[model samples]
Target: MSKVLSKEFLQRWAPLIVLFSLCIIVSIINPNFLSVRNFARLATSSAAPLMLAIGVTFIIIMGSIDLSMEGVMAFCGASLAVVMLQFNSFVEWGFLAIPVAIVFGVAIGFVNGLIHVKLKIPSFLVSLGIGFSCIGLTMVMTGGVRVSASDKAFRLLLTERFFGFPLMVYVAFAALLLAYFIQKKTALGRNLYAIGGGEELAHASGVKVERVRIIAFALAGAFYALGAMFAVAQIGSVASNLGTGFMFVSITSVVVGGTALMGGIGGVWQTLVGVLIVAVISNGMVLVGLPTYIQEGVLGVLVILAVALATNRKAIQLVK
Candidate 1:
């Protein structure tokens, strides 16, 4: 009985153990990696990706993927930048811009959901097409140019720190908490799990599968928009290419957090830990003087390994 219990414990907690060990190893290699300033910087730098990962976690929970993340983020950033720069002339609007950006995000997500549900198309293709369309739209709006950060208040929201933590970190924590609530306390959350487990079964069980999926996609879009806003705030500018490569990075974080790719499992808290692991590896690589170009390759390998360890292959069967 003790041996059986030990095995279960290791299976459940192995990822966290590995992540903590890596942190310790990296810090030992470079003491600066453990400094307070670096810890703060890491939290700030990871905020956007963490938001993105949490958003994607919902979509994955429904056995679907949202590749429109990069496009959604780019659109949000571009729109926000244009509003605060070209339209408002850097005037402070007292947080009104944030809600407006969030609304735009939901609208984009709704459209994406409509396309998927109405056309009966696979999410992958629908999201890819929508993402491309958003990119084209952004290009047309910005004329392929960068938008400078002009809003003092918006900039402060990104740069300011409270109690030694960046404002963005607080925002991220709030978002994470909201996600946790939705996944745990809401009926919609339970429906998501059911759909992920078996869509037809969920529909037969009166889960309102379509509505839940649409809402999930919409919520993900909102999160992506928030992430984009944070990105622009952090960098003080917006470019057409601002969200490039985010799709894979966000998905990687989710998978690393022990969320099953086959779906019907995992939660936002797992995503939080996964985001930290990815952030630590990336930050540590830089601190250890690894070449920037090699980072992607390293991440790719780690992603495969993590998936292999976390996935329950016996529960899932494949034709191939």
Candidate 2:
């Protein structure tokens, strides 16, 4: 019994343990990697990707993928930029623009979900197409140029620190709490797990699989929009490439956190840890004098290895 318990504990916390060990090793190699200032920078830099990972976590829990994060974020960021910057004679409302971006995110996500569920299309292709379409729209709207905003209050949300922590960290903490409540206290969350376990069984068991899926995707979209807002607020500008690499990074974080790509398991807490691990690795690499290109290669290799270790190969057979 003791051995079984030990094994269970190891399985659950192995990723976190490894992550911390890596941090320690990196700090030893470069003392700057453990500085307080660097820690603050790491937290702020990770805020956007952390939110994106949380969003994708929902879709993964529903046994689906959302490759549309980049597009959704780009659209949201672009919309916020145009609205607040008065791009086309549109009136600017300081804080109100945030909700408008979120709404557009939900609408786009709903359309993506509709295409996947109603049209019986795979989410990968559907999301890819939709993401490209959003990019095109952004280019057209901004004429392939950057959009800048001058809202000082809006910028403070991303720039200001409370008790030595960026305001975005507080927002991420709130989002994490909300995700936890949804996963543990809501019927929709249970239904999502059931669907992920077995879609046909869930359908036969009276779960509104389609509705749950659609809602999950929509929520994911909203989160992506929120992340985009953070990006814009932090930088005080928006660009077409604002979300270009987010989809890959977010998915990588979720998978590294021990969330099975096959779904029906894991939660926001795991994702938070995973995001921290990834953030530390990236930050540490720079401190250790590794070139940016080499760091990317290392990240790719680490992602592949982490996924292999986290996956339960015996429980779920590879479909392809």
Candidate 3:
């Protein structure tokens, strides 16, 4: 009875406790950690990665991984930049250009899904390939050149205040709200969790696992493209390496947010917390004077600890 109670307590409260503890520690380390400016920066810094994490959250919960995000983001960002650049025919696309970029993203995602489902390819291998292809596509688009947006209206988003925060911050919150709704109220969302809990059982229970998987991936792709677009907007430019290092950080945010690696657990709320934590850590380190070289290692060790605590390992028959 005690053991069961302890397990329940850990499952319900451990991650939140750790998150608060981390926040307290960081705050103590840097007295100015709670400043409004710092939080605004955290929101903006987290915006793109938060979207990427949300994109992959469904896949991860369905017991699959997406390693293609960085590539997809770079490719999508480069594509959008190329479309909006002043020097090309594509530049004349006007406001309709955003939809074009989104459609392009859906295409990439659809291909990733179709190929994975039809061929039974492992997501890890397939996503990595997709990612590399995206990077290559970006390279082909740019030939080692950077394209900056000249649109003041678009670029103004990074600094434009909406209520008390930047416009992009509200956009991020809207994405979060939409994700939460999908997770809580949609058949597709419930199907995703069921599939994660047990793919074989889900298959037997009348769930169209393949179809749902494909939709999930395609949705993920759309979000990734949106993230890339926002990222480009934030920086006002795009390059072949636009999405470099994202997979690691976004995955870390997801895992650290208490999503189990083995799937069937975690959600958007956890992911939001995780993204904020990661952003706070990045900001706090600079405030507290921590060296850049050590931050990755620190985050890595934290990730391992987070994974161990988040996963209910004793129930698993195997680890692979």
Candidate 4:
């Protein structure tokens, strides 16, 4: 029993320990990596990707996947830029465009869930198809042109600083808080764990598995919309490829933060740690003059290791 408890403790705390270790190692290699200014930069750079990771956390926790983030983010980001342009600036009613974009995301997510459950399609394939469709639609909407949301008010998310961190960081924190609440304090959160642990068992226990799954996906979409807005705020530009690199970052952060790919484990806090870990690694590599390709390769290896650590291999006989 003591051995079991020790194993559990280590599994629960390993991600955090790794995170601290990475910080120390990087700070040692390049002391400037520990500076307040660099920390602020890390937080700023992580804000949008953190939102994306938070969104996918729900889906992954429910034993499902969401590859649609890139497409959803691309669509929403482009839409936000167009709305801001139409209103001349976010200082006008363009601010309303934020919620509107999120609503669009919610609708798309709802449909993605509907198709996944009602049509008996696997979530990954369903989400991937929807994402492709969204990307195509986004290209058509913008006529393959890059849209800019250079409004001073909107860009303030990046430009305005409070307590040495940009406002976007705070916004991402708020979103994180909201996700934590949902995961820990709500019936939906409970149901998500139930389904991920064992869908048939959850359904047997009268958990309304399908409904919970759909709700989880919709919730994820809302966060994706926020990610889209944040991305535009960070760069002041939105193109069809705005979400190009997010899929890898968000998924990788989730898994590396200690979330199991087979689901039924991990939460938003782990995701936050995971995002910070990735951010630290990326920043540290740059500070240490490591190539981008090396950074990507390192992240890939980390993902594989994380998956192996998080999986219960003894109970699994199949590799699917």
Q: What lDDT tens digits, residue by residue, belong to model 3 across residues 1-320?
A: 79766976776666677778877988898868778777787788899999999988888999899999999998888777777764343335544556767777778888888889999999878999999998888888889798776566666667688755788888888988998999889999999999999999999999999999999898888888888878988998888888988888888888888787788888888888888788878887888898866767877997898888777667889877
Q: Which scores better on lDDT, 2 or 3?
A: 2
Q: Output the number of the TM-score-best candidate.
A: 4
As for lDDT, the candidate ahead, 1 or 4, is: 4
- Runs in model 3 deviating more than 4 A are 1-5, 86-93
Q: For candidate 2, lDDT tens digit of each residue in 60-141? A: 9877888988988988998988877653323445567888999999999899988899999988889899999998888888
The model with the greater lDDT, 1 or 3, is 1
lDDT of each: 0.85, 0.84, 0.84, 0.91
Instruction: Estimate candidate 2's alpha-carbon lDDT, on a 0 to 1 scale.
Output: 0.84
TM-scores for all predictions: 0.94, 0.94, 0.93, 0.97
Ten contiguous residues with the weakest lDDT in model 3: 86-95
Q: Compute the lDDT of residue 95 as modeled in candidate 2.
A: 66
Q: Find the number of clashing residue pairs for candidate 2.
A: 0
After TM-score superposition, what is the CA distance of residue 118 in candidate 2 from its true location, in Å? 0.3
Query: Residue 154 of model 3: what lDDT?
Result: 67
